[model samples]
Target: MRTRLFALAAVAATALSGMSACTDSDDGDGGAASGGGTRAGAGAGKVGVILPDTTTSQRWGTDDPKLLQAAFDAADVPVDIQNAQGDKAQFQRIADSMIAGGVKVLMIVNLDSATGKVVLDKAKAEGVRTIDYDRLTLNGGADYYVSFDNEQVGVLQGQGLVRCMGGGATAGAEPPMIADLNGSPTDNNASQFKEGYDSVLQPRYDSGEYLKGPDQSVEDWDNKEAGVVFREMWEQTNKNIDGVLAANDGLGNAAISILKKDGMNGKIPVTGQDATVQGLQNILAGDQCMTVYKPIKKEADAAADLAIRLYRGERPTTGDRVKDPESGAYVPAVLLDPLPIAKKDINLVIKDGFVEKKAVCAGRFAPLCRDAGIK
Candidate 1:
């Protein structure tokens, strides 16, 4: 993984050579959080990256920054990556510091639009170009947006759930009652996830192929809150849920924990996204049906490439454009397709080098991974 990433960076450095002065407006005034802080790099120009929260998803603090930084480093572009840890105010402050430091490109995963708008507005005033990374900042006037085809992520989840539940269940059995544990309403990606999964599930529900059970939105994608809600919903439904449509890996794991207590872990199908280590492990253990794998390296590489172009004052070509749900303005976008990861396809991520063999094979999971032909 390290070797391949460095090779990518080396190539990028060649391409970006002597391109620093292409953009005159490199300095920006922007405003954020008690951040994970910044990682300063010495290069021709700097790209400032702000990840939303380490608490919500490990991708923000772990996977994304590593890949994003590697991409920037390969191209010899200096980068500063930081996290807000879910604090909107801290996110603003981090942006301010980046802007004051004369960052050429500002890429962010917004905590919320209200706070994001202020930061974007500030960056714009300082002549800094902005890229909405992972999450869109509706009407924030970001120059470009990059992320997975989030709705397709949901479609994959819904499809995976249908496979797990439909394949295992006895034909002609009573319509299965399913529950939804969605992500926070505040996130644009969360809404896209809901829409994606809902698009697949709602039709089944309407046709009586599946029955809708308890459905709830998890504020901030909080697992503890999801656990509480799932527990109560389970009790209220008399433990009637036959399938679970969890929005992401965290919520899926939360539901899995509760279901395990009731001895229903592998018996009910649960769907998730982010394809975190836990999510992959759960798929191996049969507790989770599948997870949406966005291939962080590709995502990070794309964002970094886009950031480099944006910093060089180049119009990055986009295959498509998407309307920000909030502002209804079509923004240039680079939306990558999401892949569905079930146990059989776990090898895909492994082969793609998304997860190191040792990371998933460590400890007691070694035997399970070996049993799954992962070793």
Candidate 2:
């Protein structure tokens, strides 16, 4: 099951990357005026955005809203962005309210893929075009989906762990023992990430080059729950783990906290994603192997453009369709490439304007950030 999940993450990441790159050449500036459609006369309708949760990561509060807001403002479209706080019933109620409010475009980062389908169905019935943001609403049959190359996220995590383990075998020594702490079971991106990481790690495990430890899928990407789960795994396995393949930075941080309490901070190599401030701090401290950086600005801008197009009844330039697992139908999607950030390239994210120097270089991390050339 672990291997299968990893493979799926890889495929989804690759597909998303290809899609994101393909759309880069098209100039989508000037908001809704550039697109052709019936509702193109000024701002004809409102765009509704529903986010999954705020407690999971910093991106929800900082990056996601800012990027989406900038994009929508540039497109001259009115947007209403709401957070469900990880509540399924609340998410449903929010979507229902948006539909009743006569929203023309509905963009959502689904908390659960199954619940997302219900929201999408409701939107469709109400004649509202839906875009599955970040988390794909596969069975929901959304009009469009936008997100990073999720599988590549896994590949970077997997490759980083291998590199952190010293790249080559140590004189007839068996490969390092690693644990897999993945995201929620319902999140499609989690499966995609597992696929990418497993693509690189599974072969080693099968060949007896790397040892496998307790592999578990985290529920709802909860950091506290992840910490508890890792603690239990450590107790059960007697701390035999050498490396950890944590699906995202939140879980990685959770596992790292547990390892720290056990006096195993820098001893075990761990992988992460999102390139968040806390995650980057861990990387600088040499506690994390690496993180996959998906620029939120670009992703949010693209999603906003797509939403505006849909609102104006214009056909988007998306040419590919991803097959939904539940309905077995092709769903339109936009996939973006993800960058791998290591200690060496920590400055790159700063250079690319993904993160601000002040945001990452505060408090005790200032010296570390300066040493890392993070200006």
Candidate 3:
């Protein structure tokens, strides 16, 4: 592995000599997180990263890039990172550009498995070591994977919703009507989340303890589209939804928006993930039931350590292996645990620096933050 990495780097360095380096100013560039321009001959041997988009979750645009960049910088590694901004064609273009520019290591948070397979396959063909940052590429076959235990994230979501709905196996005269607004159907993490949550919720549905209501997936985890889909669900059920199992904070907030229109925000318990600022505030406001917080800094540091070692032609080892359902292959993985955050746990997110106190405590959330014992 070490010998092949150096050979690939030598070839890339030779190839990059003739190419004009490009900067973050280039079209479709989310801009470099560590340094400007992939064209820098000095950085041609550096690791390259491609983020999915700035939309679906705030972490993609703001949190992950910042944290990942800091990790690489602290290790004194020259890295170039950019976001695809949700365009498949653009994602390919960026990957091709990075490969041609001579990056020995390539990392990505895939837009989807199909597109991700293409990128990972190309990188592997060029002998460039590949790492799946967060979302796994079904059969893409990257060299390594680093992320939180996603199914556990879903388990927390399901468990949190049950707790918010007043807990216990026994239902009242009428079982609460439950609905689920899942994430993008293309994202494997979404499937894993559904798998975990279903594991917990299915039993309740079978025993007549909870009524399964409208369940649908947002195409791209689009927030506006999420609101539209949820509104139809609300109408289809005649506004009888007693709880919402939203896959993430964005979708959870969308459900809350529709619920607010009907003056039912706090009346219906809703579940979320990502521990986003909006989701945390919603919990404080009594609009959302709970959120799952996967510390992205820890994930980024783990990934960075792997990438740095690979960039230096060192093969790193991981104790965990995740099986790819499609390809039947096991991937070396570094999986982190996730925390469930209710109203009382909101301060934990703040204290951990996952989110800033000013951001969550701003405006109308000030009093709520203080009441929650947030210092």
TM-score of each: 0.87, 0.88, 0.88
Q: Could you give candidate 1's per-residue lDDT for residues 276-368 as a string of tens digits? A: 888899998989999998877767877798787665555444544677766776666666668888888887888887777788777888888
Can you tell me which runs of candidate 1 are displaced by over 4 Å? Answer: 1-45, 167-173
Lowest-sum lDDT 10-residue window in model 1 = 1-10
lDDT of 2 by residue, 1-375 (tens): 111111212333243333322232246321122122233322456999999889888889778898888888887788999999999999999999987887888899999988898898877766676788988776677777777778778888888889888853466786678899999998998998998999999899887878888899999999999999999988888888889899889999999999999789888998888899889999988888798898777778768877876665555545344667777755665666788889889898888777887878888889998788777
Q: Relative to the unseen true structure, what is the C-alpha lDDT of residue 132 in candidate 2, on a scale of 0 to 100?
A: 87
lDDT tens per residue, model 3, 69-109: 99899989989999999999999999999988888789999
Q: After superposition, which runs of candidate 3 have C-alpha atoms over 4 Å from their true positions?
A: 1-44, 168-172
Could you tell me the C-alpha RMSD of candidate 2 in Å? 6.3
Q: What does each candidate score in C-alpha RMSD?
A: 7.0, 6.3, 9.6
Task: Give candidate 3's whole-model lDDT.
Answer: 0.83
